[model samples]
Target: MKMNMFGLFNKKKSDTVSLPYTTDIHSHIIPGIDDGSPDVEHSVALVKQMQEWGVKRIITTPHVTEETFENTPETITAAYNLLKEALGEDAPEIIFSAEYRMDENFLKHVKNDILIPLPGNHILIENSFLQPFWDLKGLIYQLQLKGFNPILAHPERYAYYYDEKEIYTDIYNSGCMFQLNWLSLAGYYGKETRNIAYWLIEKGYVDFLGTDLHNRRHARAITEFLQTKEYRKLVEKLNLKNDTLK
Candidate 1:
């Protein structure tokens, strides 16, 4: 995909990769390979959008599920190369990670050395947003055993877990880190999700923040959110310790 799709701006070196949104660790902007930024051009648009928002480092994570999109390292490698070509070396640092679907198949993959580990042994993980995991406790136990910390993506969007507050505490105590999506805070995922996002922030339950930018619609939402007092409060309150981010 060409960077022309979203039209990269002609900015100075210092302006190009400034840290307005220092670390965006979760995104589906890896192009047409998953249920995300469509094609290479679309993915470029997503990254460029993030770059404009002051995101210096982007860890683009596509979905890896058992029923669908059964992504492996080989599959991610090819896409990563293509994405690298699209972004060029001068672009902001782009890393590869996967938002793993914590399903029955996940256990097997984790055991068989098929799962991709996030930098520093951090693994981005997601459960069904519609339903709570049937055996969530056991799954969390397995993740701990694998020596990887599971970072749950968009916990606010999970309908079932929002009602059961204990599930959040359980997951937190289970040693799973939580990430909140930018759009969720902007009410793009609906009011319920917005409430949950704020609740996590207010209660100090969130560990990290992400763009989760898949397309222009999400891009616009995040752009607007970054300007809000609420977004400022969330980040300033957290003072997240993502040292590798520039």
Candidate 2:
């Protein structure tokens, strides 16, 4: 991934920038889970890193895709327990949730009421890159009827929707919230994602800002981004909904 001169500057901040949120509501830090930490030690390390970045709590979200991850509540809980045990007493508060993909299996789980949600019944959902879900609007309505507030994770990363901003507006109008990946602002993904992220922020459409932290590399990027002036301004300007999870 290419980054600008600002993102390349990695010196530790002389003055602290107060993080906007007391809690980070999205991540993949549970050990041995999906594509996140490979082991307990790495999971603990990531948690500590987030703590240093001023996040008081984290709700790690593992992928629960049908074809790939296929994670269940039982599996996620076991992993969370293992991570919690490894952290001992000094670690910040940790919670567990799943980033659900809108597929047949997800619909089954939704109907079964087996989904785990954030503090406010907020359930994170993502789309496939191949194509948008055909009934996304209806699905959001159904999720709301089932008492789950669906949050679209990293909407900027969906390149297909970039051509039409109204699609995002329609999704939001359907009662689904948007979560902006913190890495997007650092150009960790690319310039297109970065531009879309800022555009969403400018339109007051961003409801949450998440680390989406998977491993050390992503952690380092977030740490570097936080050191820059732009990141601090975003923290103030967006007024992200992460505080609601606290």
Candidate 3:
């Protein structure tokens, strides 16, 4: 296999290196919910793999989009409960949260005060793939006013921002933290995303690193990436905020 930015292959490790964050704050491990794990078996299997990766706790963030997923709190909790029952006591500690795609659905949830915040009252929010939310800043302000720490999910994946990259700093300055996808550094999403990931790290704007693990493919990619030197360097330099959540 060809080694990409993360030293994915063509490199040998002298010793094992684990991620700095023990609790993964972003993932889609709740089965039959969204675009993540498909069923209970897959959910348990993915959690086991996460445990193998040294994740002591996992806060799975399933998608809650309008019309598309429309996953409610009751639905998410039921899926979480099923996974918990399937895993018994051997599974890694798990928590249920939703990846809010700053859309009308999210706005309704926010207004209703039903959005599930991650540790420290942090809300993991993202933009639409093609464009950002028009009232993104205002939404962040509202979230903050309501005592929710707004976390922008996978800013590098927003291709629109590649041209106007200064928006990243603007978002960060607006008091919203950035969550980087681990696959981006591994060149899993392609070189552009990988370069942006490195750039964000170098610029001191990366606040969190999330697996964003949706299935076995993502789990395998992260497993291989962790064996690379770049992974260790990122863990050492980023000073990730996941520890605070624990």
lDDT, candidate 3, at 135: 83
Against the true structure, candidate 2 has what lDDT? Answer: 0.85
Model 1 CA deviation exceeding 4 Å by range: 1-4, 7-21, 244-246
List, residue by residue over 1-246, the lDDT tens digit for candidate 3. Answer: 632322322223334346777899999989898999888877777776776677899998999998889998899999999999989978788998889999998899999989898988999999999889998889999999999999999999999899888999999999999999999999999999999989999999998999999987787788788888777766767878887884
> Model 1, range 1-246, lDDT digits (tens) per residue?
424665443333343323235778888888777888777877776777777777778877888887788888888888888878988876888888888887877777887988777787888888886676787778777777878777888888888876688878888887888888878889997898999988888888887888777777777666666666776666666745454433
CA shift of 105, model 3, Å? 0.8
Q: Which one wins on lDDT?
A: 3
Per-model C-alpha lDDT, please? 0.76, 0.85, 0.86
Ranking by lDDT: 3, 2, 1
Better-scoring candidate (lDDT), 1 or 2: 2
Cα error of candidate 1 at position 148, Å: 0.9
Q: What lDDT score is found at residue 62 in candidate 2?
A: 95
Deviation of model 2 at 105, angstroms: 1.2
Model 3 TM-score (2 dp): 0.92
